[model samples]
Structures are given as C-alpha cells and as structure tokens.
Target: MKSSTRSLGARNAVLAVVLAIAGLAAQPAAAEERAKDLFGAEKLPTATAPQSFGFYSKGCFAGGVAIPMDGPTWQVMRPSRNRRWGHPAMIATIEQLSRDAAADGWPGLLIGDIAQPRGGPMLTGHASHQIGLDADIWLTPMPDRTMTRAQRETMSATLMVDEKTHLVKDALWTPRHTALLKRAASYPQVERILVNPGIKKKLCDTVKGDRTWLRKIRPFWGHDYHFHMRIGCQPGSPTCKAQEATPDDDGCGKPLAWWFTQEPWRPNKNPDAPKARDVMTMANLPKECRAVLDAPGPASAEAATYHGGAVPVAVAAPEPEAPSLPATTASGTAGLPSAVNAFTATPEVGVPVPRPRPPAK
Candidate 1:
C-alpha cells in the first residue's frame, strides 16, 4: 500500500509541472508587445487627473479630453480616426484659436489629428503627437455648411506649396493667410508653429513692422496643407518633458534657406528600415505609462469630452497672460489687410450646434 501511494504522488507532481508550463506558454511576453498596438487599442481617456509622461515623441498622457466633433466655430476632420482627443488646455486653446481666427476674418477651423485618446505611439502617421500638446490645423477654411461624416473624410486639403520650386503658390497665397498665422503666433502658450518651408519664406519676405512674433513660426517639411501648433508643457504634469526653446531671432536667415536646397528633398537611401513606432515595445516607454495603460477609462467618450469653460484646475492650469503686442496691433485689427472683414457672420449649418454650458457654481 505504501509503494502504491508513493507512485501516485509522483504522478500528481509531474502533472502540476506540466500545467504550469502550459500556462506560461499561453501568455505572450510583455517585452514583445508593441506600444503602438497597445495604445491604439484604447478608445477612451483615463478618468484620473491629467498628466503627461516622457517626451513628445516618446511619452503618454492620462486624463485626456475630446473636443466635440462639431463645435460652433470648428469642425473636426477624419472623424473615423477618432483622434480628436487632447489635454484639456490643448482643447481649450484650439477652441479659442478658432473663435479668434474667425474674428480675424478666417471663416472657421478644420482641425486635423490631435492625438489618440490615451496619447501614445500611434499605429500609423506622426512621430511627435504622442504627448497631447501638438495639433494640426488645416489651412483649408471650414465650409459654410455642415459637412457630412462622409464629406469630412473624403475632403482634400488644398496644397499651398509648389512641389518643384518649394514655394507657396502665389495664386493661393493671400494677406488673410498671413494674418491668420500671425494671430495664432500671438498666444503665449504656443511655443512653436511649424509650417512648410515655403510658407516660412513667404512670411519672412512679406511680414513688415514688428517681426518679433515670427520667432515662434518654425520651418519644417510636409506642412503644405496644414500648420502644426505645439504648446509648452502645462503645470499639472510634473513628468511632462519640455522641448527646447526657439532662438530669439526670427528664423528667416540661413536656416530657412537650407530647405530650398536639394539635400532636404533627396530620396531615402534605405526606405525599408522599420519606423520607431513599429519596433517600440512597452519596455521602451516611461514606467508610469504602464499604470496609465491599466487605469480605468470613462464610461464613454462623451463622459471625458470638454464642454467649454475651464478644464478642471487639477488637469489644466490657468492660462498664462498673452505676451504684450506692439501698441499698433494691440487691438488685433490694425494690421489686417483691407479685404478682411472683422465681423464675418457664421454661416447656416446642418449640424446641431452645441449649447453653451452653464457657469460652474
């Protein structure tokens, strides 16, 4: 009887070992999971306090808020991508810009991608929007009528730059265009406004009077259809990494001249190499990001959407005072071209307009 019992106990131990190995084999290694795939799968923002971690290209953010798809002065493009989410300050800034741009004679704003709901490496396109501080505003003006979901996706943005000459097409360029960019650069929170090299050169050649605000307009590639606006790190995110400041001088000299050279447009020698997003795994991001991934999200996207007024103070710090402008342009009207109308009326729209939210008690 004792011999028989010993044999049965040995068999049970071997079975236990076999089961443990099977369990290990069933789970994929964390290091092998790509960060983009993990972040791209998220559909909503975390309900906790907002904070950004790591650099703009190599970070993640929590407590994101989505701007409504259809705002009174702006309409989000690419609705199917579900990329309108951003930090509360970013959303507020965009909303403010749209209203301000309208006052400056631009019809309305057609916003491009902001960031994924959670703000991390995307599955496709963009390398720096991971931190929720960057946004793309199409140079194309919002149409007079509300765009259908299908129209928003299919509409193509106007290309302002000539491919061969790398110059802004003179026919499409207008004084109002320059005024719009000027208004955008006036905000203190906006640290950088990246545009096509051609657009930068045009501004350098034409902008007269005080050119101080031109310091914030950066020249980069692939901005023919839209311009990129990047805000500085906010107060609540202790871990948020800030980008280097632009030089004090307007960047219209030697640096802007380089984009005109063939060196920048040269064909890639090794196009087959994988992009950083393709290989980045969870191990590559900040340790805090792991917790952000696991944090519970809101019940729906609407629950986390911004409805105007100030974002929670815990998430969005108070807006800094705008830098003082020259007395001549302090009213934001002195410099506009004669063609611009200060009081352009809002056109009729088919979409439902969002009602103003009551003031917080």
Candidate 2:
C-alpha cells in the first residue's frame, strides 16, 4: 500500500508540470507582438484629455484631433492615409501657420502627414512623427482651385534639390519660399524646421538682415520636397520629452558644408537589418502606452476634428516680438471673394457647420 501511494504522488507531480508549461504556451507573449502593428491598427483618437507620453520616436498620445481635409488656408494631402490627426495645440499651430504663411505671400499650403489617429510608430515612413508634434508642409504651393480627393492622393510634390550637386534648383527657389520659412521660424512654439541640406545652404548664402531665425532651420536628409515643422511639448503633458535646443548662432558654417561631402551619403552597411519600429514591442514603450492603446476612441473622426477658436493659448509658448519681413503681394484667403472662399463656405465633410447665433438679448 505504501509503494502504490508513492507511485500515485509522482504521477500527480508530473501532471502539474505539464499543465504549467501548457498555460504559458496558451498566453500570447507581449515581447513577440510588434508595436507598429498594434498602433498602426488604431483608427481613431481616444476621447480622453490630451496627453503625450514618451519620446517622439518611441511613444504614444491620447486626445488627438484631426485637421479638416479642407481649410480656408490649407488643404490636407494624402487624405487616404488618415494621418491628419494631432494634439489640439498642434492642429491649431498648423492652422495658424497656414494663415500666417498666406499673409506672407505664398499660396495656400499643401499639407502632408501630421500623425496617425493615435500617435505611435506607423506601419511605414517617418521615425519621429509618433507624438503628434511633427508636420510636413509641401514645397509646392496650393493651386488656385480646390483639388479633388482623387487629385490630392495622386499629386506629386515638386522636388527642390538637385541630387547630383546637392544644391537647390535655382529656377524653383523664390523669395516667397524664403518668406514662408521665415514665417514658420518666427513662431516661438516652433523649435525646429527641418529641410534638405541644399535648402539650408541656399538660406545661409542668401538671407540678409535678421539671420537669427535661421538658427532653427536644421539640415536633414529627404526634405527636398517638403520642410518638416516640429513644435515643443505643450503645457499639460509632463511626460512629453523635450528635444535639445539648437545652437544660438546661425548654422551657416562648417556644419552646413558637411552635407556636400560623400561620407554623409554613403550607403547603409547593414541594409538588411530591421528598423527599430519593426522590432519594438509594447514592453519597449512607456508603461502609460498600454493604457493609451486600450483607451476608448471618439465615435467618428469628425467628432474629434478641430474647427478653430477653441484651442487653448497656453498650448503655445509666448510669441516673441515679430520679425521684420519684406512686404509682398496680398494673395491668401483674406483677399479671396466670399463666394469662392473655403473659410466662409461649408466643407463637404468632417467639419460641423456653425449654428446661427441667437439674437442678442
């Protein structure tokens, strides 16, 4: 009887070990799940209060708002990408820049990618637009007429840099282009404006008088067709990481010349290696990111869209005294007739029309 009891006890212990192994196998491992796939699948922003958690390349955000496909001074390109979303402050800044850029004599803005619905690593393109503060504005001016949705998707942006010489194509460069960059850099909230190295060289050689703002224009790869505008972290998000400040002097010196050399252009040594986005799992992101991913989203994309005037002023840093710029021809929405002006007319979708005001008591 003692021998039989000992044999039964050993069999039970073996069964327990087998069950433990099976349980672990049944559960999905967080390490095996790629963050890009999880974040890329999100289609809408959380309805919670806006907060950015983590670095621009390795974080996520909540309470995102989408810029309308068509605005008075701007039209969002690549509408199908569903990337027009950003923090309320970021959306407001873009709208404000559009108005300011128009006043500075450039045509309407052809807006590029802002961020995915919930800012996180994307399925493709960009390493830093993950936190809803980075935006890409095309070099090509908005055409005179409103573009069709199909056209916006198919349109090609004009390349401003010559690949062989690494220089701005002289014919395409204009004073208005310079004015647009100046207008963007003038805003205090704008921390950095990234452009092609060639474009940086062009600005360094030509800009006169107030060269102070040129300090913010950074030289980077692949900005030949568009310039990237990046704003600093805003008021409520304590978790948002701030980038290092640019040097005080105008960057027209040896740093700008380095891009002309062959070393910077050398091909990647490990082309087959995986990108950080490809391998990043939920474990790699901030602890808050999991909660952000699980949070509830708005009913529709339109429900969370920014329609102007409600943005908190605190989101932006105080504006510095305005810089002096050359006077240019008046051509933005301000001059457009009310009948044709998009600002006055109702947008086709995603933006609610304003209700008639009650008569004053």
Candidate 3:
C-alpha cells in the first residue's frame, strides 16, 4: 500500500507540472493579444466602399490603393514593412510630390510607410497613419540609379539634426531639401508637414522670403530622418476627420523656438513617465470599420484590391524577407490587433521594433 501510494503521488505531481507548463504557454496567446495586434493579420484591405474612418490613430481604411513600388520619380523603401497602402488621394499626392521634387532639381523621393491595408492601430511604427491619409518621405535623396531590392532594404535614411546642438547638421542639410518641403507645403490639400524643430529652424533661418509655406511645416519630435506629410480628409468621406487647421501665423517664431529648449526633451519627472498611447480597440473605432476588418478580398492581392473598377497595384520595393513578426517588450508584452495568432504564424523572426512614431505635431 505504501509503494502504491508513492507511485500515485509522483504521477499526480507530474500531471500538475504538465498542466502548469500548458497554462504558462497559453497566457501569451490570449491575454497578451490585444485588438491592435489583429491589424497585420489582415493581409487584405477592407473591400467595401473606399473610405477612411475614425481619427488618424484609431481608424481603419476600406478599399485602400497601393502606391506602386517604382514611379517615374519615386521608389518605396522597406518593402517588408508592408505599409505602402494609402487612400488614392494620398497616393496621388505622393506622385505629385515626386514630380515636384524632380522639377526642383532634387533627386527622386524615397517614400516610407504610408499605412497598412485595412489600417487600424499598427503592430508597430505609428499612432496615426491608421486611416491612410499620411506618409513619410525620406530626407535621403533617392539615388540617381535604380535601387536594387536589397539596397532599398538596407539603406538608412540620412539624419539631418545634430545631436549636441540640437540643430541641423551642415554636412547633411541642403537648400534643395527646403525646396522639396516648400513644394510639399504649397499643396492646398496638405494639412501639415512634420519635421524636427532643427529642420524648421534651418528653414526659418535660411529661406530668403515668402514664408507662407512655413506654417504647414510644424516642428515635431524624431522626424530628422523623414518628413511626415498629412493631407486633409478625402473629399467626399464624411466619416473622415480632418485635423485642426494649422494656426494662422507661419509658426517660425516663438512656437518654433520652443522645441529647441530643454522643456520638450526634458526627461519625464513622473516615475512612470512613459504612458502608452490610449489603447484602441474596434469598439473605440467607427462601426463601419467592423465590416472593414472582416471584409473579404482577392487572394492575389498585395495590399490592394479591386475598387471602383480598377485594381491598384500594391507597390513595394523588393523585400529580401517576409513581413516581420509582432514586436514584444523584453517582458514579452505584445503590441496588438491580433498579436498572438500572427506572431505564431509569422515565418520571419527577430523583427526589430520600429521607432516610436509620435502623434501629429
């Protein structure tokens, strides 16, 4: 009886250990998977009417069009990022920017992430761009030669700001960059342009006259490498929300000076100074987005779908690898729309966390 009791006790202990292991593993899949994590799992854009819904950070897009990989004057960067999708108006704006840049005697534009197809909170990289109305133009000029797929993946954007002085670096700064920015700002459709305060200062100090476009280029954090361009809402989409108008003045005075001071960059005194952006769920978004998220699409779609009788090609610079896995904290906390299942199924590994994208400046 004693021997039988010992054997039974050991069996029960083994069973308990197995159950504990199972429970521990299960926690990552369910508890850690938030709604934002699901955005990447959606391989296709919402196939309903073409519309952008909710504000920039909490919305989704339907019938998104892909900006093609190579345009006459623009080429995309980071093909594996799968962020080339945008509203058609936004795409057209980029196309125009490319043409304008060339006309200004500047190299072609090296475009960065615009929005994911079926944009919602992204797995990484942005708080906005959720509704497909924003884009990033690399400060680095597109090379005169056609970029190889591998070169596009590996090349780094030029940093324009100097670290010690918090000002523009002379070596990397140029008048043509100012010309490109002025061109982007001149577009009436543009709501704003976000750049490092240093870049804004350079513009304010250097541009000879006609400061009108300066109002559109507002100062923001961490955009020394690229300028973020946001346009007004798509013309007919009432669901789309327009950001507040840029203030009346050119914003080159006190407002611009404030960014270079200690206040903006001062370390948060709050012991818990870093707070996450408001957690977004489908519940927090427009009701129409529910159908957008669940909508079906063409199997061959590359973030583009058949909409309004045209199949816009989803353009990406060739990628050496597949899209990355959902980013996780050191403690294994995952950012969401469907962090769990997507992470589980992702073929790629060790995806770098994208730099934290600040909300609109």
Task: Indicate the residue-level lDDT of 292 in model 3.
Answer: 69
Cα-based lDDT at residue 339, candidate 2: 21
Better-scoring candidate (lDDT), 2 or 3: 2
Which regions of candidate 2 deviate over 4 angstroms? Answer: 1-31, 311-361
Give the per-residue Cα lDDT of candidate 1 at 249: 93
Per-model CA lDDT versus the true structure? 0.80, 0.80, 0.73
lDDT by residue (tens digit), candidate 3, 1-361 = 9999999999999999999999999886556444567777776664334567778877877657677788778889998888888776677678878998899988899999998877888777778888888999999988888888899899988888987787999888878998999999888778799999899999989887798788888999889899999987763356677677787678888888788788998876786642233355566778767666665543445545322223343333242433322233335564332212211222233111222223455
Count clashing residue pairs per candidate.
Answer: 0, 0, 8
lDDT: worst 10-residue window of model 1: 337-346
Residue-wise C-alpha lDDT for candidate 1, range 295-355, written one tens digit per residue:
6666677667776664431221223432221112324444322122111111341112223
* Tens digit per residue, CA lDDT, model 2, 272-341: 9999898888888877788777766655776677788652211211333322111111232222121221
> What is the TM-score ranking, best to worst?
2, 1, 3
Cα error of candidate 1 at position 217, Å: 0.8
Residue 74, model 1: Cα distance from true site in angstroms: 0.4
Clashing pairs in 1: none
